[model samples]
Target: MKLAMKYIILYVNDFDKTMNFYKEILGLPVKMQHDTYVEFDTGATTLSINTRESIKEIIGLEMPASSVASQTFELGFVVEDVVATIEMLRGLDVPIYKEPVTKPWGQTVAYVTDPDGHYIEICSAME
Candidate 1:
């Protein structure tokens, strides 16, 4: 059997804020959208955002609270300049989880959390 992942859906409390972070801040074009749901054009795998309340009501899910301190999952994005990207987000009043640090493998990486506390890694392309 074979399987392929198509979307990474983030169930969020503040749908508008999370939507704006990915759309206005990260600059991901919206692939589709509704009052409670949105999908971004993120390469082959779509980045989706939906309201937590909606999902819970629909699927009867009891999702745990969002957390940045506790380990969970991370979303990665490659940018041209890690430092510049971090600075840009910082200027917009986005909370900076970690400053940019060049890895021993030659890739510069940094971390930040979204409105729902999902960790995102901003990095330079692997060299």
Candidate 2:
């Protein structure tokens, strides 16, 4: 058997706000969109945003509560300059979870939160 990962779907409460954040803030190109679903082209993998109600209707079960306080998962992005990315995120008024810092492992990383409180780590390889 063979399997290939394709999409990471984030079930959101406010569909429009979440969709707009990915589209306007992160500047991801929209691959497809409908009343309840939106997909963004992020190179090899696609990032999809769906409404909780939509999932509930499809699965015929109540969706569990989603919380950012759990800190269980995050989306990471590799950039050329972590500091510059942090500065740009600050200018956009994005919530900063941690300031840019170089780790002992030779990576400069900074953390930020999206509108839905999902952590986004911006990092660059240390020279």
Top-TM-score candidate index: 1
Q: Candidate 2, which ten residues in sequence have the lowest lDDT sum?
A: 62-71
What's the TM-score of every candidate structure?
A: 0.91, 0.87
Off by over 4 Å in 2: 65-69, 125-127
Query: Which residue pairs collide in model 2, if any?
Result: none
lDDT of each: 0.88, 0.84
Model 1 misplaced regions, further than 4 Å: 64-70
Highest lDDT model number: 1
Prediction 1 global C-alpha lDDT: 0.88
Task: Give the distance in Å from residue 21's predicted Cα in candidate 2 to where it truly belongs.
Answer: 1.2
